[model samples]
Target: MSKEFEIVREFEVDASPEQVWEAVTAGTGGWMWPMEEPEPREGGKGPFGSTVTAWDPPHRYVNRVENVEDIAEQSANQLDYTIEPREGGKRAWVRYVHSGILVEDWDNQYDAADKHTDFYLHTLREYLTRFAGRPVAFATFEDGPEASKSAAAFTAVGRALGLADDTAEGAKVRARGPEGQAFDAVVDYRNPYFIGLRTDTALIRLFGRNHWGYPVGISVHDFAPDADGKANETAWRGWLDGVFSA
Candidate 1:
C-alpha cells in the first residue's frame, strides 16, 4: 500500500512577521529556497510548477505540487508556511510542513528530506538575521557517487580546505580540488553547528548535522553573483564528493 509522509519544522526567527512574510514571498534573490519564486496568488505557479493554493500575507501561505520534480518515485508533495507575530511584534514564529506520498524507497526519501530541512531552515534564519535586504544569489551542489554520509565527513571537508577540526573564526583557508576547483577565504563564523566563510567573491556557509543517527550530508552555499555560480557549483559538488569518499 502507498503511504504518506510529512515533515514539520518550526523556527523562532529574530524578525517581525511582516519581515518574514516578505522574505518568504519575495521572488528569487530574497531567499535561498525555491529555485524560482511563485507568484503570490491562488493558482500561481511555484517552484517546479507547484501551485499556490492559498496566499494570506504575513500569515499563511501554501503550495501544492501535483507532480513532484527531480524525484521520479515521488508523485505529489506540498509545502506550507505559517508565520505568526511573537515577542510583541519584534520576532516571528514560523512553521513549515512538507508532506507527500511515497510509493517506493520511502526510507531514503524521508531521511533525505528530514536531514535537508534543518539546513534549509537554518539558511532562512541566516538570511533574515543578516542579509534581509541585500542583493544575493544562492547556489547548491549535490554530492556524486563517492559521497559518504558518515561522522568523518565534516573533518574530511575541513582537511580538504587545510583547516583543522577546531578551525576558528578569522582563520585563513585555502582549498583545491579536481577540475580546477579552488577556494580562498577567511573564516567569518565557526562553531560546531555551522561554519561561514567569506571570500572576495562570495559568502559560503557549511552546515554539519546528524540526522537519523548518521551524518546527514555536506552542503555549501555561495551567496554571490550568478555569473560564476554554475562553474562553482559543479566544482564544489565534485570536490565534496571526492572529499567524503577519501
Candidate 2:
C-alpha cells in the first residue's frame, strides 16, 4: 500500500483579510501560478485542471486535483487555504495544507512539495505587501532540470542579484544573468525567506531554498503581462541551465 503525506504551513501577513482573500480567490491583486484565475465556485475549474471543492469568501478555499496532466493515473492531491483576521484586522493569518498520496518515491515527492510550499507562501506575502489591488500577469515555463539540481542553481542566481544579507526595502537592484539577460528593479521586500523586486514594468521575486535535500533550484516570479513572456522564459531557462551545469 502507498503511504499518505500531508504538508502544512502557517504564517501571518500585515494585510486585511479582505485584501488577502481577493488576492487568493479573484487574483485581483496577485496570483501564485502563471495561469488565468479560476472561477470562485464549488466545482469551478482551477489551475492545473483542479476543481474547487470549497469556496468561502475571505475565510477558506479548497482545491482538489483529481486529474493531472501526466501523473493523473498515479497520484491524488488537494490544497486548502484558510485565512483569518489578526492584529485587530490590520493583518491576516494564513494556514495552507497540501495533502496527497505517493504511489512511489514518497520521500522525494514529499520533500519537493514541502520546500515549494514554503516558497509559494512567502510569495503570497510578497504579493499582499507590494502589489495588492493591482492587475498582474504570469507566464511559467517548464522543462527545466529536476528539483534537486535546480535549487543550487537558484542560490547562485540570488548571489548574482546581490540578495545575500541585504534586507533593505526600496534598495536599487541590477543583475545580469547569462547571455546578457538582466533585471533592473527596486527591492520591494526582503527577508531570509524570499526577495521581491519591482521594475518599471514588472515585479520579480526570487527564492533560494533546498528542494528535496539538494540545493539545486531557484524559482523566479515575473509579474508582468507583456508579449515578451515566451522570449523571456526561453532565455531564463537557458541561463539557469547553464548556471546549474557549470
Candidate 3:
C-alpha cells in the first residue's frame, strides 16, 4: 500500500515577503534547515541533488525528498507565498504544502516520515517565524472591520499598508468582550502584482505558477492585549496610533 501524507502550514509575516523569503532560503545554516545532505538546486549535483527536485525563484520553491529508497519510499514538498494589504503598506502569508508517498515498505518508515517532516518544517519555521530571537505573531483567522473599533483601554492604531483596491481581501468586525479587555484583528491577503510580491491568488491559473508563485507577503494585526496577554484591539490600536502617527 502507498501511503501519502500532505501537510500545509500558513503564516502571516510582519515584514515583506522578500524579507521572509531570504530568511527561508537563507542558506542551510539555521536550526531548522529543511534541506538534507544535498545543496538544493534542480537536477544538479548539490547535497540535495536527487531529492531536491526544483527551485523556481521567489514564489514557489519545491522539494522532492527521498530517504534510503527501501527506507522512506518518496517525499514531496511545496512552498507558496502571497501578499495581503492591511492598514496601507503590505503584509504576507507563506503557505507551505508538504506531502510524500510510501510504497512497498510502508511500516518501516511510517513514523519516521512524520518525524522527519516535522523537524524539517521546524527548521525553516524557526528562522522565518521569528527574527532577533523574538517570536512574531500572525492572524490565522479574524472576524471584524479594522476601521471602527473600540480603543478605550483596549488601545488601537492604524496605518496604511499601501494603495490597494480589489486585491485587498479581508474581514472586518467589532466585538466586545465580557472579560478582561477587547480588541480587533484583521486577517488579510493581497494577490496583486505589487512591486515586491511573487504571486496573485486570483491568477492561480497557470500550473507552473503554483510552484513558483508563492506569496511575497503575509501580515497580521493586533490592536490590544487582554488579561491573557493576547491581542487586545483597543489597546494595540491606541499604541499604533500613538507610536507611528506621532
Candidate 4:
C-alpha cells in the first residue's frame, strides 16, 4: 500500500543564491550528513544515486530516483530546490519541495518527515549565518536500547544537559555532558522535538525522536579543521550510554 506525499516549504535566509546552491549540492555536511557531491548538470549524478532532472546554477535544481528497494517499494522520490537572491544578493529565498511515496507506516513516516524538514531548514540557516564554507565532520548517536523504549528518553537527555522546556533560542548555555564533555554554546534552534546548539566549532542537534516512537538521536556537525567524525561519534555514544544508565 504505497502512498504519495509532498512537502513544500518556502523560507528566506541570509545567504546569497550561490551560497544556497553550494550548500544544497556540495556543503550538506554542515547541516545534514555528508552526501555524494552532485554533478552540476542535468542528467548527471545526484545524492543517493538519484539522477539530476534539472540543474540551473544558483537558481534551480531537481533530482529524482525510482525504485530504491531499501528506501521505497516501487516509488518515485524527488527533491526540488529553487533559490532566488534578495537584498542585492546578500540573502536568498528558497523553495524546497520533497515529493515521494511511502510504502508502509505512512502516517508515522509523514509526521517524521514534516517535522524533520523544519529542523533541517533551521539548521541550514544557522550554517549559512555562522559557519558557511567551513568543512564539517558529521556524526550521529542514538539512545541506548533501554532508553529508546522510554517515553521520556529525550526529556531525560535534556535534563542531563541542563535544558529547561522553555530554553529560548540564542540563549547562552554552559553544560557538561554525562562524560564531562563541556558545551559553551548558544541555543540556535529549539522545538518540542528538536534542539540545536551552536558552539565555536560545532552545530549539535538533539532529536526527541522518542516522541515519534523512535530512539532519541544526536547529530554533530563539527567544523574545526581537525575535527574527526569517528572520535565525535565515539564520545557522544559514551555520553548517551552514561545518560541512559544513570
Candidate 5:
C-alpha cells in the first residue's frame, strides 16, 4: 500500500534568508550531497531529474520529480523551501517540507527519512554558520562492512572516537582517527542517531543508521580551498574499516 508522508522543519538559523537560499539551491554539497546548481528560473532542471515548479530567490523554491522510470516505489517527490528574514535581516526563519509517497515498508522508510531530515538540516546550519559560500570537497563512504549492520555499531564507533555516551553538543572534543588523523573539533550537533563535528576545515557527519536496521555510514565536507574529495574518501574509508575491524 502506498502511503503519503510529509516531513516538515521550521527553524531559525544564523544566516540571512539569501544565504539560506544559496545553501539549499547551489551549496548543498557543503552539508548534504553534492547537488548541481539549479537554474534560477521556473521550469528549470532540479536535482534528481526534478523540475523546478517555483523559483523565488531568497524566499521560496520548489521542485518536483514524477514517475521516473528507474526510481521504484516512488511515484512522485517534491521539495519546498521557504525562507523568511529575521533579526532585521541578519538571520533566517526557514521552512523545509519534503512530501512523497512510499509503497513498501512505509513505517521504517519514513522513520529513517524523518531522522535524516534532522541531521541534514543541522548540517545546513553548520555550513551557514561557519563555511558559508566556501568551496566544498564532499566525500561519502557508503560501503560499510557487515559489522556496521549490528545495533551496537554506532556505540562501538563512539567508543572508538572517544565520545562519551553523555557527550553533548558544543563540547570541545579531541580524538584521533583510526589512521592517526587528528580531530580537534567542537561538537556541532548531537542526537542519539547522529553526531556532527565541526573543525576548522571540515564538517564530519556520523550517521547511525544501524538503529534503523541499516549499515552505519560517514560523510565529510571539506571546505578548504584545495580540499581533495577522493583523498578524503580514501582516508575516511581506512578510518571506517579500522574502526569496524577492531
Candidate 6:
C-alpha cells in the first residue's frame, strides 16, 4: 500500500475566483492573512491560519503539522490545497488534498477535513454574504420567498400554543417553575435545535439546511407530551403524527 493517500475536497462557492482567490490566498477575509502573528509569505513555513502553511493568495491554502514526519514518512504527510478559477471568473472551485498518514491518524482524517473545509466554507460564506452588505439567514430559508414572520416568530409561536404571555414584543414563555414541573427539567426548551415546532396551529417547522449547510435529515429530539405535562413519553405521538400528516 502507498504510504500516502489521497483526500480531495471541492466546493463551488458563489463568488468570483478573484474574490475567492483573495480569501483563499490570505486576502482580506482569508483566515490567515491578518493575525497578531505574522503570516507566511507563500513559500515560508506558515505558522497560522487554516493550515500550518500560511494560506497563499487567491483561493488556495494548505495546513500541516510542524513535523511532517510526525504523521508519516518525511515526504508523505503534507497537506495541499489548490484554488482555481472556473467559468471565466464568475465562480470559483476549491480543491484540497491531504497526503501522508502515519496510519495512526487515519481515524481522524475525516474529522480534520470536516473541521477545515466545513468551517472554512461556513466562514467564507458568511464573509462574502456580509461583504455584499445584506441580511442572509432569514432570506435563504428553503429556497422560497421571504416570509414576514421568518425572522422574529418565536413569541408569535408561543401564543398559538396557548401557552405564552402576550406582549407587544411577542409571546413570552417562562421556564417551567419548580412546582409546575411535570418532568425533571434538564435544559432550556426554547431552542428549535432541540425541538421543532409548529409556527401557528398549522405549520410545523421543517429543517432543510443551515447557513453552513443544506441538511436533509437533522438529528434532534425531545420527549413527547404526557399527562405530567412534561415531555417524557409518546402519549400524544399519534395525535402529533396525525397533525403532521394532515
Q: What is the lDDT of every predicted structure here? A: 0.69, 0.67, 0.36, 0.85, 0.86, 0.38
Put down candidate 1 lDDT per residue, 1-246, tens digits, no spaces.
457999999989999999888787776443354366778788898777799998888899998897787877688899899999998989999999999887777896687678667756766776777667665555564333333445565566666667788878878878554454666877776655456666664556665543223442334444555545556567666666666554
lDDT of 5 by residue, 89-127 (tens): 999999999998887778888898899999999898989
| lDDT of residue 29 for candidate 3 | 35
Candidate 3 per-residue lDDT, tens place, 147-225, comes to 3223311112112322233323344323222232333422222232211111111010100111122212111221112
Give the poorly placed runs of model 2, Cα more than 4 Å off: 27-31, 72-74, 145-174, 181-220, 223-227, 241-246
Screening candidate 1 with a backbone cut-off below 3 angstroms (N, C-alpha, C), the clashing residue pairs are: none
TM-score of each: 0.73, 0.73, 0.37, 0.94, 0.94, 0.38
Question: Which candidate leads the pack in lDDT?
Answer: 5
Ranking by lDDT: 5, 4, 1, 2, 6, 3
Query: Which 10 consecutive residues of model 3 have the lowest summed lDDT?
Result: 201-210
> What's the distance in Å from true for residue 83, model 5?
0.7
Is candidate 1 or 3 superior in lDDT? 1
Candidate achieving the largest TM-score: 5
Query: Per-residue lDDT of 128-245 in model 2, one digit per residue for the tens?
Result: 8866776565544444555424435555666766566554777886766548667677887565445567676555555544434444333344455553555656766676666556
List CA RMSD, all candidates. 4.7, 4.4, 16.1, 1.7, 1.6, 16.3
- Name the runs in model 3 displaced over 4 angstroms: 34-47, 51-54, 65-90, 104-126, 129-246
Q: TM-score: which is higher, 2 or 6?
A: 2
> How well is each residue in 168-219 modelled by candidate 4, as lDDT tens digits?
8889999666468676888888877888888898998988888777787889
- For candidate 2, the lDDT comes to 0.67
